[model samples]
Target: MTAAIRLATARVGDLAAVMRVMDAAFEPAYGEAWSGAQLLTLFALPSARVCLAWDGEQVCGFSAARIAGPESELLLLAVDPRFRGRGIGALLMKDWQAWAAGEGADDYFLEMRADNDAVHLYEQSGFSECGRRPAYYRGNDGMVRDAITMRRSRDRDGED
Candidate 1:
């Protein structure tokens, strides 16, 4: 966070760097970090887009989304643990929305662990809880966790 961070559209070649960020951002106890093969498959999808936040040559954070019709679903968002609390996560969210808007998205949605503390951050970003799925994830501790779906309506005019 000491150095200024810049957001950029991530290229296919950046997959490894983005996966590294995902690994560093998610804890094993949470069982939420995505595998490289999974990410590689997503990158190959035409509906998917990946964006990266860079501090010099290093990727501090990244976000990915799937766009279909007028709807966009945030598939993943992560910031390196060391870079957290520095506003990188919020930046990634904003960038993701902007990109979605430019792609003609009018409805944005995302789902995450119900107990995730980041819920407040999403609320502040204009998302509202729209639905929930019970026992959607089984954590490493062998406890089941619920998933909450949050959504935000974007104007077709494209204003963030």
Candidate 2:
């Protein structure tokens, strides 16, 4: 049976998968910088919401966000390498955006390495580069990389 992609509220049981994808996606860039405990805290935070794309028991993609004080932040998003370019990332993002808007967020923010290829996807989804942080990420070899901060607005009253 083929697993369908859908949206659901994240639960404590999802922590293992969340850690897996986050480390898989950021390992090259963050070099084990984030521990599972840290990820658990983020996932368990009241302001943060998570959505996962699953293929049966396996998680193919995931997106996480934090919404509070009229602002939201996309903390993580990733598609399994085998599932990239299949619109799964977009689906996860859309789910997060909808949830953010419903929670009273007027805008969303995300930060990624300037060189990350996924930056284009975020841009295509209407995110705009708002600023940059120098030496924001610690690479595998101990080198620091620049990060670009992006933002997207959902309009007053949450239109579009």
Candidate 3:
């Protein structure tokens, strides 16, 4: 039987696990994986938060985000390739949103390469395309990709 997955708030010590997941989930050609130092910087920020998903003692996924004033942006979200299709991404999305809400964020945003398959995942989580930046990312393969920005608002009652 496989181990049950669980989510937890990530601490500085979980950096290694986060890196492991990021390395396994992100393609090197995309050049999207962040370094341990970068993650540590985020961890130091009072406005940022990180959540990790664990399968037994192993970290299977992680989501990082930050809240600024009334806005929250998802900095990164990754699930180990071996653990995809098991709803880990969706779970992390939910945790990110919940953390943002608790932080009093009225809007949530995320940006990713235009061709990223996670677009569907964000859409299913209530995020919609809001903007785009042409040639925003130059991958390791020497190819440039557009960046797609997505947003989700907490004012769902039409009472803004």
Q: Whose TM-score is greatest here?
A: 3
lDDT by residue for model 2 (102-147), tens: 8888898999887788887898888999999998877777788899
- In model 3, what is the error at residue 10, expressed in angstroms? 0.8
Which digits, one per residue and each the tens of the lDDT, describe model 3 over residues 1-160?
2238889999999999899999999999999999999999998999999999998889999999999999999999999999998888989898898889888888999999999999999999999999999999999999999999999998765322
lDDT, ranked from best to worst: 3, 1, 2
Instruction: In angstroms, give how far residue 54 of model 3 lies from its true place.
Output: 0.9
Backbone clashes counted, model 1: 0
**What is residue 97's positional error in candidate 1, in angstroms?**
0.8
Give the poorly placed runs of model 1, Cα more than 4 Å off: 1-3
Write the number of the candidate with greater lDDT, choosing between 1 and 2. 1
Off by over 4 Å in 3: 1-3, 156-160
Mind giving the per-residue lDDT tens digits that candidate 1 earns over 75-158? Answer: 989989888898888888888888888888889999999999889889989999999999999988888999999999985466
